[model samples]
Every structure is written in C-alpha cells, then in structure tokens.
Target chain A: LEKEIAAKDQRAHEQQKFYPDLSGEIAGAVSKRSEPNLDRDFDTLDEPVWVTVKRDLNTVGAKFGLVLFPTQGNQSLLRNWDLWGPLFICVFISLLLHSSEGKMGPHFTEVFTLTFFGACIVTLNIKLLGGTISFFQSLCVLGYCLLPPGAAAVLCKVLTFASEQSSLLFVIRLLVTSVGFVWATYASMAFLAGAQPPRRKALAIYPIFLFYFVISWMIISHSH
Target chain B: MTDLEFQSFHNQVVTNVQPIRDDDGGTTYEFQHSGDIDRVKLLDSENGTNSTPQGNKNLWSFEYYQQFFDVDTDQVMGRLLNSMVPRLKTNFIAQHIHPIPDLYGPFWICVTLIFTTGICGNLAKYIETAGSTINGHFESDFHLVTGAASAIFSYVTLVPFGLYSLLWYRKSEVQYTYLEILSAYGYSLTVFVPVSILWVIQLESVRWALIVVAVCMSGFVLAFSFWPAVRGDKKLIAFGTIVGILGLHAILAIGFKEFFFDAALQSNKFGADNADFSSGALDKALTDPAPNAALTLNDSQSKNAKGAEPKAASNKADDKESSKATANGAPVATADGGGQKDAAKV
Candidate 1:
C-alpha cells in the first residue's frame, strides 16, 4: 500500500514537471514587486485575450523563423491553412508594386482570381488523388509555395524598368527569374510530397509545375 | 533404420538452409529499421520546440518606440559607423544581439542625407547653369524643396516597403523580422551619405566610379549580414534575394543620376535658345566693328538694314525732295509779290 502511494506521488510529480508553472510563478513575482497582497490579485487576475492572441502570433513568428531555417518544427506550421499569412502578404506587396503603372484594379483582381483558382485546382487534385492530407493542408502548402513566384513577379517589375536600356539586364532578369522559378518548383515538390499517394506523385506534381510555369511565363513575357 | 537416417539428414539440411535465409532477411530488416530510426531522430531534432515565448513588446507600441529611442543616440551613431564595414559583429548587433528600438534613426538619417545632397546637387547645377548664361539668370522648373522632399519621401517609403515585401515573401527562409530587415536596409543607407556627397563632384567618370563602389559596398554589407542565416537547399533563393537587393539599389542610383544630378540638365545649358542668343551676338560683333556698335545703331538704321534695298533708296529720295521744297518756298513767295505789283501799275 505504501509502495503504491509512493508510486502515485512520483507520477504526480512527473506530470507536474512536464507543465511548468507558466502563469502563477511569473505573475506572483510581478505582483510581489508592486503589491503586498499578491495572493488576492493573483486569484482575481485573468490573462487578457489579446495576450493569448499575441502569444500565439509570437509562436507563429517563431515557426516562421523555423521555416526560414528549415527545421523539423517547421512541419507543424506547414500543414495549417493559417500559415498562408506570407502568401497574403506577398499578394499585397505585388499589388503595391503593380500600382506604380496605374490601372491596378484589374491587375489586383486577376492576381486574386488566379491565386484562388490555383489553390482550388491544387486542392481538387489532392482530393481526387486519394491523398491523405486535408484540403486546407494542401491549400496551405500551395499558398506558401507561391511566395517565390510572387517575389519573382516583384523583381520582374524592377527588371522591366532596367531591361529597357540594357539587353544584358534583360538576360540577367531572365536568369534570376528562372532561378526563382526552379527554386519554387523544387520547394513546392519537397513541401507537397506528403500530400500525394506514392503511385500518383508525378500526377500531383503536374499542377504545381503548371502553376509555376504560368507565373514564370507572365513574368518573362511582361519583362520583355 | 536406413529410411529414418535419410529423413533425419534431409530435415537437418532443410533447417540449416532456413536459418541462413532467416538471418539474411533479419539483417536487411534491421538495417531498414535503423535507417528509419535515424530519420525520425533527425526529424525530431529539426522539429525541436516551435513555441517561442513572445514578449509583450509590440512593434507599433509607444513603449517599444520609447525604449528604442531611450537608448543613447551615440549607440546608433556607432552602429552607423560600424555599418560602413560589413562584418559579423555589425550583423550580429543589428540582427541578433541588440534590439534596435525602431528603424527611425537610421531611416531618418538616410532621408536627411538624400534630401540634403539632392537639394545641394540641384542648387549647384542651377548656379552653374546661371553662371554660364548670357544674362546670368536661370530658372528651374524643378523646385528644389519640393523635389527633394518628394524624392526623399519616395525613397523612404517605396524602396523600404518593396524590400520589406520581398523579405515577407521569403519570411520562411529569412530569419530577419520586418523590423530587422528595415533596420538593416536603413543602416545600409549610410554608404549613400558619402555617395550623395560625392555626387556633387563635376567629373562624370569619377562620380560614376564612386557610385559603383558605394553601391557595391552597400550591397556587400547587406548581403553579408543576411547570408549567414540562409541555409539548406535555399541558397538559390538567398542569391536571388541578394541580387534583388543590389538591383533595387542600382535602380535608386540610376534614379539619382537621372533626376537629381541629371546629365540632361547639364547638357541643356547649350540648348537651341542659348545657341540662338550666342549666334545673334556673334553676328552683331562681326557686322559692327565697335564693341557697342550694335547697341548704338538706331531703330531706323537697323530696320533699313533688315528691309529691302529699294525701300532704303526710296526713303532717301523722299528726304531730299522735302528739303528741296523748303528751299524753293521763298522764291515762290517773291514771284507772287512781283505779279501783284505789276497788276497795280497797269
């Protein structure tokens, strides 16, 4: 009976160790500094919702850091639709760059429609292929994967201005963009590899290849 | 006895062969299992904890700005000085070690230099053009203050935002936060200060050379600072980022050349109007020997010179006739008096 009690205590201690006292200890220390009656305030104080939200955002930020560095932790952030933050940011950026030429409304609409349709097509392909990944996960991977092409688009705008005076610049722009295109293709392939069944992997890659090809074509054609 | 012995020997042989096959299969299975285990371990190591504790300090918060500014201005100055040299320490301080409060200091400093030098360069050109003109007067359609302000504003807002957007797209592979990228870009502008000042030099080749060097230096610093963080198969992305950065800087430099220190403006001093004025003066000097002869020439003489030869001759004839009429008026009056006297005598 005593041995069982000891084992129970040990189990409780182990569980407690795993979850460090996140709130209480920090709050206790802070409250101790400012107020003498720490216990009463500590009991009454409720963490703000914004604080939790901010913390989650920070976690996302950290995940972004991991993505940049590319660690195992990046995989968790990879499969969630919430990770499409960078994609939206890129879209906004492209809009800003495109606005320079005036008549940005059409361009903005086109980009949005294309990206949406592209995501839908990819999602549909994944669904039809008997892949294990969810629709949102596919969308998430596709969205983040579009970043390189989006960036290439922005660079192409700069290149358009540059290419006018120098043919060398045009060639440089082409090379740089092609590099981005290849990278995007490779990155998407690596990232989306899990979403497709083993037998149909090549089939799943076709859409990604098509998507990037269209983007590269647009960038290259416009640059000329 | 013979049948039993034969069956026992066959069973022994079968057992021996089965053990060999089993051993081979077991080794292969174990090898694959170990590989899988290693892969899992690698993934686990890579995936370490994703949740990083976020501080309550918001980038847009006043407290954050306050803290950023609260630091010694000298520290920023030191950073500006250090930014001139592209190295690990400067990068570490800018990116990792110190939390630069805001990009305000570096940004403003760059803006100030850009505007100051831009205005100065424009003014210098204006003064030079004025000095070269016949009337010593030059009017610029480009307003100095307005032009400088607009250019600075565009540089501050557009270029940084463009870069920020690029970084945002690469956020997964770029470890730098928006603030860090902005700060790095802002610090990178320090090279431009000297470049801007050098722009005032009249030598085109020297100016171009200096600009190229400055741009390279600035690009190198920025690329070096961000290079270490880029890893894995994303080296191509990193190269693209660096190239994009250099391209943006080059565009700005080109813009500075085109608008601010415009060679066209310099060349325009010898425009058609100036050519006409100079040629008119030359014609006057060649036609009239005296220095002020062109000024002394009356309107009629100059007009006659410009008019037809027959018109001038006609004008001279009309002048002689008017003089002759005055001269004959006295005789005509006497003749009339004599005729009136004769009539009285009769």
Candidate 2:
C-alpha cells in the first residue's frame, strides 16, 4: 500500500513538470502564430506550382502598385528587393522602343544595354557617393520607378499608331514624356534620394535625372 | 593576346635599357628583378584603390577591365581640361595617359557628346523653323539619338582602330597600344559638346565660325598628339596621317552641320516644292543661294500641306500660286530660300 502510494506521488510529480512544459510550448506556438513574417516562407512542395506563381505574381503586382502610387508611408520595395518587376519593365520598354515601320527607334539590344547598364552605372555612382542603399535595392527601385516613363512610352506608341504625325501630336507626346520624366525622377528620388549623402544629393540626383531624361527623350522622339 | 604582344614589343623598345635576348638566357636573371619591381610599381600606380597584380590575370576577368576605369573625378577633370588646349608640343598620350590609359574620360565624354549632339541638333531644327507658319509645334525627333550614336560611335571606334592598325602595320617608332590611341581620340572630341549646344543659334555665319573653332581646337589636339607617334616613320607617312586626321575631323564637323542641322531644315522647307522637279534641277535650286519669293509661299502652303500630292503634282498651278503670294510682299526670303527656283523649274 505504501509502495502504491509512493508510485502515485512520483507520477504526480512527473505530471506537474510536464504541465509547465506543455504550457510553455502552447505559449510559444501562440506567439509564432501571431508573428507577421510566417507567410514570407512557404513550402513550395506542399502547394501547387500555380499557387506559388500566383502568390509571386501578387507580390510583384503589389510592388508595381507601390511604384505607381508611391507615398511616404510605404517603402517596402527597397527593403525586399526583387528583380521580376524590373525585368518585366525593362523588357517591355525595350520591346516598345525597338524600331518599327518607317520609324527608326533604338534597337532592342540598345535599349536593353541602356536600361540595365545605365541602372548598374547609376547604382555604382550612388554607391561611390556613399549611398546607404544596397546595390540590388537601388537597382530595384530604379527599375521599378521606370513605370512612369514606360507608361509614357505606351501612350506615345498608341498616339503614333492612332493618328497621323502632326505638330499637335508631337506637342502631346512632348507633354506626356515630360510628365513621365518628371514623375519618374521624382518617384525614384523619393525612394532613393535618402540613400545618398545629404551634401552629395545633387550629384546622385543628377545621374538619375540624366538617366530618365535619356529614356524620356527616347520615348518622345521615337514613336514619330 | 594583342595586349601581351604589344606589351612585350613596347617593353623591348621603350623600357628596356638592356637589349638582352632571352634565348641566350644569360642576363634573364638580371632582367627578372627589375622587371618585377617595375611591374609592381606599374600595377600600384594603375589603381591605388585595388592593387591586385594584373600581369598574371586572363583578359576575360573582370579585374582586367577594371584597370581601365580606375580614374577619380579630379583626374578625369584634369585630363578633360588638358585635352581642350590644342598646343603643338603637348603629347597627350605621353604626359596625360601613359602606361595606364583610363577609359572613363573617353566613355563619358563620348556619351556626353552623343546627348549634346542629339539634343542640340533637335534644338537647332526647332529654332530654324520656330518662326514659320507650320504652327511651330515642337516634336522631339528620337531618330537623332540613333543617328548621333551611330555617327559618333563609328567615328570614335573606327578611326582609332584604323589608326592603330596603320601604326601597327608600319611598326612605328613609338609603340602605342590601341587603348592609348583610343583614349587620345576620345578626349579630343570633348570640345564639341559645348560647340554643339551653341549651334542652336540659326545663323550660317555663326555656325561656320563655330565649326572652324571647334575643328581647329580638337583637330590641333589630335594632330599634335599623334604627330609624335608617327614621327619616327617616313615623312610622307607621318604627314599623311596628320592630314588624314585633320581632314576627317573637318569632315565630321561639316557632316554634323550639313547632315543633322542643315539638310533636314531645307528638306522640311522645300519638300513639297521639290516633289516634281528633276533631280538636277532640284540640286540647282538648292544651290541657288538666293533669298527668293518661295519663303512666303512655303510658310503658308507647308503649314498643313506637307506631302499634299494634289498641290505638289500640279506644278503649273503651284507657280501661279507662288507668284501671287510673292507679289503681296517685298519677298521676306531673308534666310534659307530654296523652293521658288525648284517650283519655277518644275
């Protein structure tokens, strides 16, 4: 009877120790469930490929939206750098800039080299100026910010295809391209301007200005 | 490979105080120590930022190309300023860019010139036609960017390549690597950037004067810089190279004037009038050098009538119309008049 009583007591002690451990595990799991970063890592093998692609596409679209409507409150683009948006924007712009019938525009390779290399050089310039941004982050911001000019290029291409070449059309193109140039420069500066040293802001901004200026020039001049 | 070969030849001719053939292998031991020290110093001086030994690296490595771009802003600015002063005695390759030829000045200078030429060319066109009756609506012609790129790139690349080959073929007294010559040629084009911007003033006299000044400044730099490279060659060869260099320089300036700035303006003004005229007659009319009555007619008619076959196809009707338009005024054909003579011929 004493042995029986002692065994019960020992079992009670083990159960008490396990109770605290179980409670701690429950608390840990609750905290992990509430963590915001849980969705960032997903098992690709557990889900369908389409799900992965769809989620990736959603992320890219959200990035594009951020670039399009850049506000001071949202700057997640530089924090999580991705090349998908940049690649798409670059290829689309290059494809649009390629020479079409009767109009002599920049070749595809020319546009590609200009965009990729131009971004690389500009990023290098920023780094040389002691910018706080990472190389890819600056690149992502620059590439994504090209959306405005890309939109302008699209509008110009449509205008060229829709109507005859006239001074009025040209004026419209100039206005559209100027807007795109200004918006692109401003947006990129908004994202990347802080990365540069305060005193050398102008130096960093100048290259960005020239970079977009060249692209804007291509847009305004090429479609006609 | 060519760099290695040229380096060997260059070392044999210029840096070798002792003419010992390695086949004998007797003085090779003596050459090794000095050569190593010289190489270390050269590598150090080439890029103080990254003093990686470049001698053993393959050409395909990124580090090989980095050496060519190892210039600071101050160095580039100094090199750019030095390129503008066209003195006969300044050996650009020897003094400015010696063993280490930087590509930063050449690359950026060429790019700057390309944009300047493209933008300024359009500006000149706009200024020329600003006062016309064509509504003066400004449209940026993007073709100029492509055209300027081709012209300037071909000129910079091909000219240096040709000169390098010529020098290599002749086995010239001073061995100049292709990059050194390319660097010299590229920097010499820096004077054109501002000159191109100044071309927006639509005055022929001013244009000509600008071209002369630019060509002289840039041409003298090229001629004087290259003279030493070819000096040890035959007299005819050396003078011929200099003359060729100057001629090409002048041609490029004139080409910029004629092709980009002048030709388009004339074509826009006289395109309709010259539609039906014979090719020779059109040429004659273009060269008439007269401030004729077609100015007022073109102003009114070409406003919306560009490529209007109904108007251009009927030459007789156009002539009567031109005569009526000219009789109304003192013929304010004060500038760039070409269509009236062509219309009269048709």
Candidate 3:
C-alpha cells in the first residue's frame, strides 16, 4: 500500500507537469489580445495572408529598428516579417531623394525599374534553387537589405553638394558603397538561408551578389 | 467515485468557483479559475514569483504621474544619487523582485524628466536673452517646445537603436537583451536632468561643468553595464564600445547645449552688446544735433539757394575741419562722419 501510494503521487505530479502553467497561459492571452487587430486565423501555418495596415506599420518600425540595430533586428525579422517591407521603403525613399539631387535625375524611373528587375531576378534565382520562401517575402528581404547602399547614396549626395567629384570623395564613396554592397549581400543571404537547400545555398547567393554589385556600381558611377 | 478520485474532483471544483451571496437576494457565482485572473495578476505570475513587493498598478501609467512619484520614489532617489551604479543592478534585482519588466517605468520617467527639464532650460535662457536686449524678442515658444520634443523623440528612438546595432555587430557573444541596453541608456538620462537645470544658470562655465558631469555619468554607466558582458571577448571590442559610448555621450551633451541652453542666443547677445557699444559711440560723435549745428545751418542755406555752389563748397570745408576735430578725439568718428556724408550725397 505504501509503494502504491508513492507511485500514485508520482503519477499525479507528472500529470500536473503536462498541465500548462496558469500564469503563463494568462500572460500569453493578454499579449495576444494586445496585438493589433490580427485575424483569428493568423496563427494558421499553411495559409499566407495579405499584410494589414497595423502589420505594415509594425514592419516599418521593425525595419527602422533593424537598420539601427542589425543583430536584434535580424533576430526579430527571422522570428517574424516585422520590418522588411518598411526597411525597403525607407531605402527606396532615400535613394530617390539622393538621385533627384543629381544630373541624372531624369533617369530615376529607369534606375528604379532596373533595381526592381534586379530584385525580381534574385527572387527568381532563389525560387529556381529550390528555396521555399514566398515571392513577396524574398522581394521584401532583398528590398530592405538595400539600406546600406541607400545610405551610401545619401552620403554621396551630401558629398556632391560640397564638390562635384574629388579624388578623396571618390575614395570615400567607393569605400562606403563597397561596404554597403557587401553588407546587403551578407544580410540577404543570411535571411534567405533557411529557405534555400543547404548544399546549394552558396550557389543561390550568387545572384544576390551580382545584384548588389550592379547596385554598388550604379551608385558609385552616378556619384562620380 | 473512489476516495482519490473524489479528492481530485473536489480540488478542481474548489479551485474553479467562488460563492457570493448577492444583496439582490440571489446567489451569484464568481469564477475563481486561473483563466479569469486580472492583468496585474497575470503580470505578477508571469514574473514567476509573487513574493516580491509591488507598487500600485497605476504607477507605470502615463496618465498617473503622481503615482510614479509614490511608487518609483526609490528608483528616482537611487538614480539621482548614484545614477548608473544603482541602475546597473536592476537586471539582477529584476530576477527576484517584481518580475514585470520594471524598465518601462523608469524609461518613461527619464524621458519625461529630460523633456520637462529641457523646456524649462530653454525658457530660462529665453528670459535671460529678453532681459539683455531692448528689442530682442524671445524665440517662439512653439519652436522651443517642438525642438525639445523632436530631440527627445530621436534620442529615445534612433540613438539607442543605433548604439544597440553597433554593440550587437561588434560583440556577438554579449548576453544582454536589446531592452536591457535601452533601459540602461534611458536611466543614464537622470544625469541630464541636473545638467538641464544647470543650463539655467546663464554662465558658460556652469554649462561646461554640467556637460562634463553629464558625459561622465552617462559614459561611466554605459561602460559599466557593457564591460562585464563584453570583457571576455577581445579587449579591443570592449575598448571600442566604451569609446563609442563616450562619443555618443559627448554628442548628446553638445546637442543639449545647442538646443536647450541657447548657445545661439548667447552669441547673439555678445553681438548685440558689441553693436551697441560701437553704434552708441558713433551716434554720440556723428549724429549729435548739437555737434552738427553748423552743418545743419549750412545744409538749410544750400537747400534754399539751389545754385549756391560757393555755399556748398564752404559747407564741405567746414565739414572737413569739424571732422578733423572729431577724428583727433576718436579715429572711428571720422569713418562714421564719412559714411554719413556718402549717404547724404546719395
């Protein structure tokens, strides 16, 4: 009878363990309610939904946050697509602002379209390489990842205001755009890694590398 | 049911229900289930242990600032006295004490205090400028308020995010959360409160002293918070982070000086004083009606006789002699007279 009682007590303890902690569940429920107007089926794994205004706002904030703090931003982005779309918009705006101040301002539409085409190509490459990410997700990641280059463009524009093109300015522009290009490439590659097959991930990264190289080249040449 | 089954069943029922005898002559049941717990209770339980003392729930609410004073009195006092030293211990204390992230409370408090102090500082500087000049108008109150608000917004948002990114990029092994870093940065603003008040003193030396103290306090806190976490890595990264933090502190100090302390107004006051001195002396020498009495008479004569070239020539000779006399006393007096002559000719 003593052994049986002990066994029974142990079994009860294990059963209690299976029961979710009451406090944690309550907290989760509160946070869930606090989340901005998400649909009831937001947690459904198989379905992709259109982005809502609240989600887009959150994403924009996240993207801005990431630009300021990449490590935390990266982790947050990996966990959820909170900031990617906004980051892309931010970079695009910055690029447009910079290009508008230059002699080649009339060609901005062409430049924009070309950049968009490059993003599409990179997305296509990822798809062809057996990457499982959605087209929009790839586009979002690639667009937002262009932040460094966009920042470089702004710097170049500011420098151009001081002088049209000096050797020092050229050197600075080269260094900045180069760093931005490399950063964008690395960030996009890392973001897309999970979607691409492990063995061919490196091969998948080549199009991204080419895409950023063209962007850097465009930024540098126009800056000069 | 068996004895054990009945006991389990009874426990479940007791845990799930609360009986209440209603004054309306009806029996009303209140559920005592865990799922029905209030937000405060949920926060408390999520923090893992409820044994720690809790302040009023309303303390953290922005609407109830008075309660902030009541509840966060200890933290406020601690920040004012020891600043970053005491704040750095909050992470450790949080593990045992109020499990709810206490960072938000202090963060909001710091932000509010910084902006309030900044606006006051700007007002004081405006008053000083107003008192110093006759026609000097105070800057628009709207401008001051907007400047302070925008500055606080950026400091709270962009600056911390930038620093967090830099730290994360440089020190991947560091264990601190982004929020913890932000909290430390926010708490560091306690030093700025005193600095902002000191700006009202209207002394450059006092402003400089405040800047130094603010920078030292903030830099020390940032280094102290990050050092332990990053020390295990290559010393270069730690050194770099400390240097970056110090640089950020310096930038913030300069920004405060520019925005809150009215450095531009101070320069403008000096310019106005110098202008008054030079122009006052010039006014005495050149535009004094008594000293220009002869010229005034000669000008009227010349005006009456339009073809009187001789009188005009005589007036010019008289003017030259009088200007020489004035020049003997003050060389700048001649330049002022010459400028007036040119203006009269035009």
Computed on C-alphas against the true complex, the DockQ of each candidate is: 0.02, 0.08, 0.01
* Model 1 lDDT tens row, A143-214: 666666666767877776664634466577778778767877776666667766566676566567766665
Clashing pairs in 2: A221-B142
CAPRI quality band, candidate 3: incorrect
Candidate 2 residue lDDT tens string, A10-98: 66556654643465333343344345444423234677778778877888899888888888667888877788898999999999888
Residue B191 Cα positional deviation in candidate 2, in Å, after optimal superposition: 1.4
DockQ-based class of model 2: incorrect
State the C-alpha lDDT per candidate. Answer: 0.52, 0.68, 0.52
Error of 3 at B199 (Å): 0.5
Among all windows of 10 consecutive residues in model 3 chain B, the one with the lowest summed lDDT is B18-27
In candidate 2, which residue ranges exceed 4 Å CA deviation? A1-41, A46-54, A65-79, A91-100, A103-139, A151-179, A186-208, A222-224, B1-54, B134-140, B269-346
On lDDT, the stronger of 2 and 3 is 2
Per-residue lDDT of candidate 2, residues B225-327 (tens digit): 7777788877657665666566556656765765567655654656544223322222222222222212211232222233233443344535633443343
Could you give me the TM-score of model 2 versus the true structure? 0.60
Regions of model 3 farther than 4 Å from truth? A1-224, B1-72, B84-101, B136-140, B170-173, B263-346
In terms of lDDT, the best-performing candidate is 2
Q: Give the TM-score of candidate 3.
A: 0.35
- Estimate TM-scores for all models: 0.36, 0.60, 0.35
| Candidate 2 docking DockQ | 0.08
lDDT of 3 by residue, B27-62 (tens): 222223323444445687777554424543454553
